[model samples]
Target chain A: MITIAVDAMGGDHAPVPEVSGAVQAASTQDVNILLVGKEQVLQAELKKFDGWKKLPIRIVNATEVVTMEDNPAKALRTKRDSSMRVAARLVRDGEAQGWISAGNTGAVMAISKTVLGMIPGVDRPALAQAFPTIKGKPAVLVDVGANVDSSAQMLAQFAVMGEIYSRLVFHTESPSVGILSIGEEDHKGNELTKSAASLMKALPLNFVGNVEGRDLYTGLTDVIVCDGFIGNVALKVSEGLVDVIKHMLKESLESTIASKIGYVLSRQAFKDFRKRMDYSEYGGAPLLGVKGVVIICHGRSNDNAIRNAIRVATESATEHVNDRIEIEIQRWQASSTNDPEV
Target chain B: MITIAVDAMGGDHAPVPEVSGAVQAASTQDVNILLVGKEQVLQAELKKFDGWKKLPIRIVNATEVVTMEDNPAKALRTKRDSSMRVAARLVRDGEAQGWISAGNTGAVMAISKTVLGMIPGVDRPALAQAFPTIKGKPAVLVDVGANVDSSAQMLAQFAVMGEIYSRLVFHTESPSVGILSIGEEDHKGNELTKSAASLMKALPLNFVGNVEGRDLYTGLTDVIVCDGFIGNVALKVSEGLVDVIKHMLKESLESTIASKIGYVLSRQAFKDFRKRMDYSEYGGAPLLGVKGVVIICHGRSNDNAIRNAIRVATESATEHVNDRIEIEIQRWQASSTNDPEV
Candidate 1:
């Protein structure tokens, strides 16, 4: 069975959701989970669930917790035995195949990188987020809030990583990658995207030129690459707009008696729609280009999100995604060195 | 009477929506409309609308038309007598108080800036888009695809211009301005936003520091400023997400007979919701920092959008928004030079 480490002292309401999610995953999936946190708090939470003792879940003691307010560098240096750090250590020490956290994102990234190290030939790791497209399949958007002020070469690397993730995880035959920009034309982006476009075009992958923001949901490309700043803004803006739309729909459906009855009758259809758009269904975003499998969930993720994240981590680990990434990175570096066009 | 010029040969479906919208605006509002386009085409379209001859609308002949595929620079130099250029010339020659176009965005910006000139002390003009906020008030987002690769000083100028636009056009008192970034912390942005933040802080405007993409619709700040590339992507992404949500809602409502019935019952409420979210209601985004009032509409705009653009252009002209923008820009420039913090 694949072993996964869960940071139980992370997240907004830690220990409870983390333990509950581990129990659910261990009970259903063929996996073992180590809940890293204060042993007593995790044990107390586990007692509330029936048959959790029979599940392949265990408590791993952690002496400290990293608060949300703590800076990433400070948390990495100071909180040596924090739950997040302990989780990363478990993966590094071969105690677990993968690690999952729902904590301060920067702290989780820093600790995971410091402990697990970087895959050879990779300059920086990226966060690859899966977005549900209009064509009923998920697409990967890479470098979503991982590093800022990235260079053209970094963006080109992200495109390759995102393409591989789409092919392996999403099961695309051959993923087509596009760089996000203001327009779909070749000459239409800021300086970063413009230079990145040239670099990406010369790569061995299927590089479809530039794409605009409207194409994000169009499913025209299997993978989209952008800098962390633009990618993060796009992600958050989509979330905000979706919330406002849902709010508007709710207000309209409850405004009158007829509409209220209609809403009740059509509740199942709405439920299905909600499930399709729910972020928790996709689990967590994977930190690519890292030496080990590390999945990072939102700070406010719930039990369902955590359980799904574990499932994703198990699949990623079992597939040996990191090994494949290292192979691809080495091949890319060789091609760039030999290709006269580059 | 306040006279407004309409580019009758612009938009995806030229002359039809323009002439119809001009007739509606002239009949309803206390304004005169100049339809600038091919004389014969304008006459043919005007003939389809009954009683248009009795309205305060006149057709101005233009010998050329700028197609969508034409480059902005090329169109400016070659198509000097095009409908868009003729309309801008009308505004510049004191025959019209303002001008409205639903043509190519780049072409419109190029022609308007060349014809009307720039407000003193303003380096580059910006496009300020008004968005409906959760608090039921509109917030202005500036530099929406005007200039890319902007400097820190230019961003500071955008903040000042956006502040003036919000206060004058939206009628917000002492508007609060914020810089768009990845995080809300003062130190959470890229190099561009970081340097821009310091410059904005030294200005005399009510600077609220940094805001994230989620704050775009929260009504927390009256104005949000960003570089054109980021601003354009944010605007387009919001639009794309809204379209997807609406599509999902429609698909769900049609999945079952019960939902179909519910949709019928809730049709009025849904209509109200649609009206509130409709882009036509808010009209075109005003191009601020220009010497004259200019409103640029979407290429796919309908009759209602054109009519509303006319209304907005009239209001902007009546308020002397350009003069106000000039005064505030001069004040910001003076303060930036004298402030020690800068």
Candidate 2:
């Protein structure tokens, strides 16, 4: 059974969702869940569910919790026994094969990196999220919000890492990598993308030139790489737009009696649409380039989302994605040095 | 009557949409339309509309056409007699009060900037577009695609210019300006946004701290300012998401017989929803900081959009938004100089 560590004290409403999700995952999957938080609280919360002791779930005591307002670097230095830190430690100690958190994103990255270390030659680990596309499989976006003002070389590394993640996790054969820019032309974006595009061209990966924001949903490429600032803004913009569209649709459907009846009759279709667009269905985004499997979920995630995150963590750990990433990075670095233009 | 020059050869389906839109605008509004293109073709296109001679619309001959694929700077230098250039020339020569185009965004910006000079204190003009918000009035976003790799000073200018445009065009009182970033905190962004926020703080405008992508449609601020790179991506992402959402909704509503019937009954609700989210309702984006009013419509704009663009251009010209922008920019520059921190 794959063993995964859970940061029970993380997220907005922690401990409850974490405990319940652990129970659900343990009941369904052939995995072990180690919930790291205050032992008393986790036990109390787990008791709410039926047959809690019979499942493969346990609570590992953690003394502190990392709040959203804390500075990431400061938290890393100060909060030694924090839930996120303890969870990372569990993975580092080989007690658990993976770690999952829905806490402060920056703190998670800093703590995870400090405890798990980095893959050799990898400067920084990126936050890679799977976005649902209009086409067949979801596309992966790298450096979603991990590092801002990423260098061109770092972007190239993100491209390679993202490509490996897409291929290994999503099972895409020969994933096409594209640099997110204003236009598809070679010389269309700002200085960073221009440099990154040239660097990607030197790599052995399938670099498909530049892509625009519209291509995010079109699934024109399997992996799209960008700096964290742009990636974060793009993700948030999609969320905001989705909220507005749903609100507008709800208001419109309730405006007239006929539309109300129509909404009731088409509820199943709407349910299917919602399921397709649901972020929980894809689970958490993996923090790529780290030495171990670390899945970072949304802070507002519910029990269902937490369960899905645990599932993803189990699969990623079982697949040994980190080992492949390390090997691929070394190969890419060697090949990059061979190219004189690089 | 206010005179507006229409680039009759612009847009995907040119001349047809332009002539018909001009006829519609001339028939309704007290405005004269100068259709700039090949004289014979425009005249023949205009003859299709019933009693077209009675409308205050006429044709001006231009020998050349600027295609979409031409380089912006090269087109400005070579396509002297192009329809876009002629229309801009009419605005520069004071024969027309405003210029409107639905084709070649970069070409329009280049030709308009060259033919009609910039405001005295402005270094580079910005493309500002009003977006529909959940609140009362629409919020405005600046530097959508005008200049990339913009400096902090240029971003501050965009903020000031965007504020003036919002106050004048949207009739907003004391418009609040926010820097677009990953987070709303004072220090939660990349270097560009950080420096830009500090610069905006020194300005005379009502500077709200940093705003995020999720804040774009929330109407939390009246004006959101960013570099062209981020702004352009945000705009395109919204467009792409809207397209996907609409497509999904249509497919869902037609998936089953009951849903198909429900969709037929709820057509009015869907129409109302579309109208609320319609880009034509807000008309075209304005190229601010130019000496005269210049409205740049989308390449895929229909006849209704063209008519609305004419309407917006008339209002902007009559309101003398450029004069306000010049005065506001000078006032901001003077205030910024007085502050030692800036």
Cα lDDT, model 1, residue A198: 93
Supply DockQ values for each candidate. 0.76, 0.81
Model 1's TM-score against the true structure? 0.98
Candidate 1 docking band: medium
Please report, in order, the local distance difference test score of every candidate based on alpha carbons.
0.89, 0.90
For candidate 1, please provide the TM-score of chain A on its own: 0.97
What's the TM-score of each model vs. the native? 0.98, 0.98
Steric overlap count per candidate: 0, 0
Q: What is the model-wide C-alpha lDDT for candidate 2?
A: 0.90
What's the CA error at residue B101 for candidate 2, in Å? 0.4
User: Candidate 1 residues B1-342, lDDT tens each?
Assistant: 899999988899997898899999999999999999999999998999888889999999999999888899999999989999999999999999999999999999999889899999988988888888777788888889999988888888889888877887778999999999999998798999999998888778899999899888888899999989989999988888777777877898899999999889888888878877777777888888888989999888889999999998998988888888888888776776787765
lDDT of 1: 0.89
DockQ winner: 2
lDDT of 1 at A215: 84
